[model samples]
Every structure is written in structure tokens, then in C-alpha cells.
Target: MKQTPNVIVIEDNDDDFEALKFAFEEDGAPGLDIERCTTGPEAEHALDRLRDRAEISREDRVLIILDLRLPGLSGFDLLKTMRHDSRLRRIPVVILSSSSNQSDAIESYTAGANAYIRKPRNFDEYVDMVGSFRTFWTGCAELPVLG
Candidate 1:
């Protein structure tokens, strides 16, 4: 069977999501498929997609990029659930919010986010940041899962 890298991006902003998609394509992430969920409820449902045997039980790596502030359940709460869930606890979570507040970073870590990354200010920087994410999830770094 063909390998599919499980990548999830929980973001509400359309522009940012598009930017991330564009950057990943440019970076050449093989077998990388990004699933976008615009709201907290949407993200929750998206997580259900990962529960499928076709998606989860193939020795694939699952990485989640989450925005800290989201409508409905909120990213912080989502992180908590992801960390606690038996089915989802193994996936690594990266907080890619625009929030520069230390509290947001601290709270995300406190809630079990694997990484906290502040959004860049400029377009070039944003692209660079996306490249970094590609590197982290797809390149040399080894992903660690709780489950």
C-alpha cells in the first residue's frame, strides 16, 4: 500500500491555510496530505477521520498544527483532549498561533502541546516558518507519540 503522511491543520483563516498549502507544495513534502478544519467543531470531526483504520493503522506519522484560539471548543481544549485520548494521544501537536503572548505559549505547553510557534509577521517570514514546519514534520526530526 502507498504511504500517506497524516497531517492536520486546524485553522480558521482561509488565507493562512492557503499559504500553508502553497508552502508545503513548494517544499516538496512527499506523500503529505493536509486536512483543514476551520473551527473547533470542524477540527473535532476531522479528528474522527483519523480514527479510520485506513488513516491510522499504517505505520504513518500523524502531526497536528493547531491554532490556539478557535471558535467553539477552542484549541487549548482540543489539545487537552488530544493529549488525553487513547486513540489520539500519540499524535504530536504544534501550536501555530499568531498569539505572541507568553501566556498563550505557556498555556499551550501546560495543556500538552508538543511545540508552540508564534506566527511570523511578514509573508516571507511566514513562508519560512512553513518551511520549518515541513522540516520538523517531514524531514530529519523523529516524531514522538504518546500512545
Candidate 2:
């Protein structure tokens, strides 16, 4: 497992993104490097850059929190692209969506998402969720060493 992986958040909603940022700060997420991407293209570019640099610098281990809906390309589409790209395929992608649809969850898993997490209804729950995620992903779990 890698020491600490960078986190890439692909979300379009301003409020949700703010809440996630606050949660990260409040929970004292350890060793987390966050990169925000509001659009699919932006995320793709970010991923490309990350992959390129990782290949050269041996910096691997990336986690992506993606929303289902977006202005341009959808999160599912991005997931597919990542899965198809060998440089990006191993990065853990967790779908953080407001939709609790079974089909959506199935589709995300089918598209090669590492996990599917439904967005909490309120800020408190969001904070709790963040805490749990940090505790597990950052503190306990042995993340993949993409390098």
C-alpha cells in the first residue's frame, strides 16, 4: 500500500463540493491531497496529467470521488474511459452520487468503480461520512501503489 493517496473530486454542485471540503477540514483528513474538477473534460485533463507525472515520478495511488451527473460528459462515461486506459485503470474511483438508484449503483460497479456511495441528506451526515471515509481510506486501509 502507498503512504497516502491523492484524492480527486469530480463534482459539479458548488454546495456539495463546499460541504465535502468542510468535512475534510473538520475531520482532519490525514495526508490527503485534493484536486477538484467541476467538469468531465477538466477531470480527464487532470487524470492525464496525474498519470503522466506518476509514470515519471513514481507517484501513484489516486482516489476519485465522482458525481453521476454533469454539464458535459457523465461520470459513468469518465469511469469507462479510465477503465479503458491502463495508466488510469487501477486508481480507485468511488462514485459519490445523490442518486440511490439500484441501476445506477449496478452500472457504476459495472463501469469499474471501486465503490458507490450515496450522498447524505444533510451536512452532519456528510461530515460523519467523511470522517468514516478518512478513518478507513486514509488511516487504516492499504491503498494500491499505482507506481
- Give the TM-score (vs. native) of candidate 2: 0.93
Candidate 1: residue 42 lDDT (0-100): 95
Worst 10 residues of 2 by lDDT: 53-62
Per-structure clash totals for the candidates: 0, 0
- The candidate that achieves the highest TM-score relative to the unseen native structure: 2
For each candidate, give its TM-score against the true structure: 0.87, 0.93
**Residue pairs in collision within model 2:** none
The residue-by-residue lDDT of candidate 2 on 1-147, one tens digit each, is 437778899999999999998999888876688889999889889878977866776646778899999878899999999999887787889999999789999999999998899998888998999999877776687777666
